[model samples]
Target: MKSREKAVRMTLVAASCVWLFGVPFAAHAQSRVTLSGIIDAGILYANNSGGHADWSTTSGQLTASRWIMTGSEDLGGGSHAIFRLMSPFNVQNGHGTGRAFNVAYVGLADDRFGTVTVGRQWDTTIDTVSGFASNETWAGYIGAHVGDADNTNASFKVSNTVKYASPQFAGLSFGATYGFSNQAAAADGSSGFANNRMMSAGAAYARGPFAAGIGFLQADRPDAQPAGALGAPGAGVYDDYENTFSGSIASTAGVQRQRIWLAGASYQFFGALTLGGMYSKTQYRYLDATALTLDNYEANLTWQITPAWETGVAYIRTSGRYSGSGTGDAEPGWDQINLGTEYAISKRTTLYLIGVAQQGRHAVAQIYGVTPSSTRRQLVVTSGIQHQF
Candidate 1:
């Protein structure tokens, strides 16, 4: 099956090349393939890791450590054949994550029409609106809002996906994605789409110093683990979703559907400061009407203080609604602040220190990748160095 898919993609590229003939050159046709990635490591100090203050070595505290290989061929007539394979890993354990690749896709790009890709890929929510979150722009792991309840992190990529991105029109652009279920009716029966499936759409506008984006995502039976697969069911998306709910929320393996709405805007001031704000609402629905919902609001700012030094601050507030019985009936929320500084030693290497503080209401303070605090307050600090190639 995999070979067949690859053959089909290659055929598409061949057909495009034949149709285009000659025009402008592709971005990297002359170069062919490019290899690049980022590696970062640091010491992480958390006032509470699983109810205890601790210190440990970690990786990807600042940016996801990844390896990427991309190739492009000029199809002529302003068309290009492109393919990319990327994988993010844990620098600490030297282990890669999220399927074989964080992204593995083949596509055709044209200056006039747009781009279309097939394979594993991110949803529109992450592509369009995640940039406004501090988790991506400034603070890293500690900056994720209430454990990334909005599902904006790249940690969850949809498998079996087809995506289309339109060319910009007057600084406006839009895109869409669809992920196949790859399941049989005899196995996953209910709604026609009552299996591993997804549909997502997003739009963005950028002009001058201002930019804005909005995105929507929906998935059904997202916890699917097909037959003959390893580990427990719902390995990828479902595990991430459960972890995002933190300690107080009830963990359930029967998530029937998931939906998300995200919006964000940012502006640059004096070419030195950037200010941004974002909002997201995520719902994990099960049964008929029961759903676990989280709403996140965030404001973040970054300032370039000098040629070699930069600083940032982020504040996030999250509110949740739970409908289950027992402790789940009581709603929970949290407020968090992240502060960070980075000093560049060279163009590709930098040192960073970031601190995070979180106060949870009716729950234990929990940083995204860390364990929940025994108390309602938690503090974390990480100092690291990053190198890029």
Candidate 2:
């Protein structure tokens, strides 16, 4: 079956190429490819990182800096062959964060059939509903939920995957993805196949300055394991969801199974102001007799004072609970506020400032990519510049 599918895709690409270029297989020049990238950096100060005021230089302040190559070959019948390769990097040290082609994929596209791509890619939730959150839009990860429990700002990707995106119809579209485990036995000499998969799907609608989306994602055996376990020579779960706030209270190591669902919407008024909000629920089932659940609610507003200047503010509340098999239950809630502004130096360059403050009740505060605070409250301020090429 897999081989048959591969053959079909190849045939489609070949047939489309022939029809688009109107030339023999060996002679065609109807393809276009382009390279693009963004570079962003900032000075960061945290009032209480691990109990000390710290200052440092950071990358990806406004956006995670990355380069990409995109190409498309026109197919005769309103169809095309497409591919993209994206590489994210850290400017502070001039190092690539992951694989060279961390977001690489090749696929076929058509106006009527949408697109189908294979290989590593983002899950459905981030692709669909994350735009409604300020964390993903204006404030960066500094405004994201702790540990990125919903995968909005985390280092999570699906491998060995096939994804489908539906063409828009009346401002509505949908997508789905499945990641294969591609593994054998577990580290503990158990069957790993039962708990080694990931799946996600989502839908979105946009019309007349209003947009909304709903999404869901789930993963099995998401917890980290001991070294040389799970048929791999590692101490972490195979295909693990990487968390930036590891060692903090928001870490996901205790989770064995994970699931998340989200809904979000946005609206623009008078062509200058925008309002948006998102709600998400994340559940973590642990092997240590503990279960964790988080409910995140957020709202934000953005104002474009002029073509070159913009500002925004956002608020987020996280309500969480922990249940132990025999222990007890606890409620840990958190409130966060985000403020930011941007001034465009040119069409492809901008300067920005962002501030985040959070107060936790019965919870610990940790901003993504920064050290956790020792107390229940934390603050971070950053100023940065970004350039695109």
Candidate 3:
């Protein structure tokens, strides 16, 4: 009888072990995939020139429309591998923005070793600093600084890159990324005709209700147009023509170089209300050809009313100083104010309103010229509904 009891107990133990291992393996094989996206459309009214009159119907008017597919697989040992493919589209015309793989990357993550990813992805500056209170919460102008001065909207995403993020430890974490130029012969000094090549790095810290970060980016020979060539008529245009003329005089004239530095912080004061601000300065040097500097300041506040309603207001100012053989030390400036509000119906649907006004000074309008009218002051208002899945 004793021998028979011992045999039964050992058999039960073996059965339990098989069940435990098989259950996890079966679940891993059944891992799920999810498809999600957001569609935002609305009407806009602007007291501006030429584009669409004072009032017109606009789609994707307030927030961009996007679709994404993401999946993950358990790799055992408290680790997982994941991938995401994001595509942004223009809902108004049902046309693709050509960013089908806006964010296509794969990565491995573990509780102890953090996460590492390769392929196109957002840099540290955008992932950390740009999501704070002063940044855009629901794709509105009011949330970001003037013209997204600090790139709070992540206007540019690094390509051909590899990135790593440390697991959150004591409310503090950091991330870094490196984008390869992918040139066949970067060291040979012969392959320098790429349209875009950039490098960026940043660090961040968050403790309780306070967070702060700083970062820098450098690009070689990036495109620099006259200040007048952007936005409205009175906007700034690239100094390209002048640079060309100057280059003729000196064969070794320097090309355009762009560098940006940014720092920002946010703190929660009461309830769901938070105050945040950021400052960024950019310098454009024309390689011993000419020089220009742009200074930007932004401040904003975010208030969460109820669980589904939020409001944001922001002010931004930018000034540009031009020096070198071309401008004779003339300076131009522009300022803008933005306001935005959003209401959520569910985790995947939202309604938003945004308004912006800007002013230009000096030949600044001529400097920052726009395709529309080059007026000194411009105002725009947009209201839209967005659905996310």
Candidate 4:
């Protein structure tokens, strides 16, 4: 029965693509599949984790290391069948927590129209806005904005999604996504239709030395589908990352809804230096009429000091306010700085060092993917190697 439903859903998605593109279907001929992966490993030192100084080996400092397989088949008329499968894992012990395929999707692409994909996938925000956010993009996961409240780091992906990506025209492109509820009950015993659905949209433009992007997402009952949070222990998996949104307030009944909106832009100078900035807002709405709102303001500068050496620095200010709870209202905030330098030994291997410092107000200091500090201040430093294939 479940297989039948999935087949029906996939068929509808293909049909929608055909209608959207208004192209006659042709027999698929050529097929190609590519397998690629990245491995990142490092050693880390932190001033505090649950109040204790710690040393440990870490994985995926720059990005969650993952194995990926992408395939495409020519279907004629400038349209094709495409699919992707990816699994992010820790390199240290070779363990990952969550769906076996963190990313699993299949779709149809048309050169004249757009592409449509279905299955578990990313929302538009992570796809569009993350490029300008250094902390969440290239500076390492620890640079993520206060628990990745804005999801620029893609701490979580939406399930049961149908996504569209428009082709670029004059350096401009836009896309949207819809995630089915795929469940029947909300935390407050409500209809699945009343919660658990999701929608997102994004747009980007890159011309000359300038680039910009904007995106937004709304998820009613984010946890209606069972998925482990990335970087945390789940089932038999060990702790690989602790990167949850800090602005969320969870009760026994759970968070009711989530909404995020973000915008970012960047400009390059002399083809050597680049400056970028971004702003984001995330809201965790609860069934008890309570809500936590997080606002992030960030900026970064990166310099290509040499053909093989790259360096950057970034700062983030994140503030949050919680209201409507029985315990009354509270405000929390964090100010963080990140610095990084990397040397590319060759095209596929690199050596890097990263440092982070954070100060908290009305909250415990916690860096993304690390244990929370007992106090309001914390520091983390890591040096690592990354290899890509």
Estimate every model's Cα lDDT from 0 to 1: 0.75, 0.76, 0.60, 0.77
Compare the candidates by lDDT and give the number of the best one. 4
RMSD in angstroms, all models? 7.2, 7.1, 12.4, 8.1
Looking at model 3, report the run of 10 residues with the lowest lDDT sum.
1-10
Over 4 Å off, model 1? 1-31, 188-193, 227-242, 246-253, 287-289
The runs of at least 3 residues in candidate 4 whose Cα sits more than 4 Å from the true structure, single-residue gaps closed, are: 1-29, 184-190, 225-251
Error in Å for residue 74 of model 2:
1.4
TM-score against truth, every candidate: 0.86, 0.86, 0.77, 0.86
In model 4, the worst 10-residue window by lDDT is: 1-10
Model 3 misplaced regions, further than 4 Å? 1-30, 50-54, 59-62, 133-135, 138-149, 186-195, 223-255, 363-373
User: Model 4: per-residue lDDT, tens digit, 1-389?
Assistant: 00001111112233344564586564333765566677889999999999999999998887667776667788889999999888888888888745588789999999989899998788887768887888664578888898787877776676678999999999999999988776566567876663457789999999999999999988765544443222223324332222354223545444567778999999999999999999999888766677888999999999999998999999999998888856358889999999999898987788999999999999999998789999999999999998777
Question: What local lDDT does model 2 show for residue 204?
Answer: 95
**Candidate 4 at residue 381, lDDT?**
95
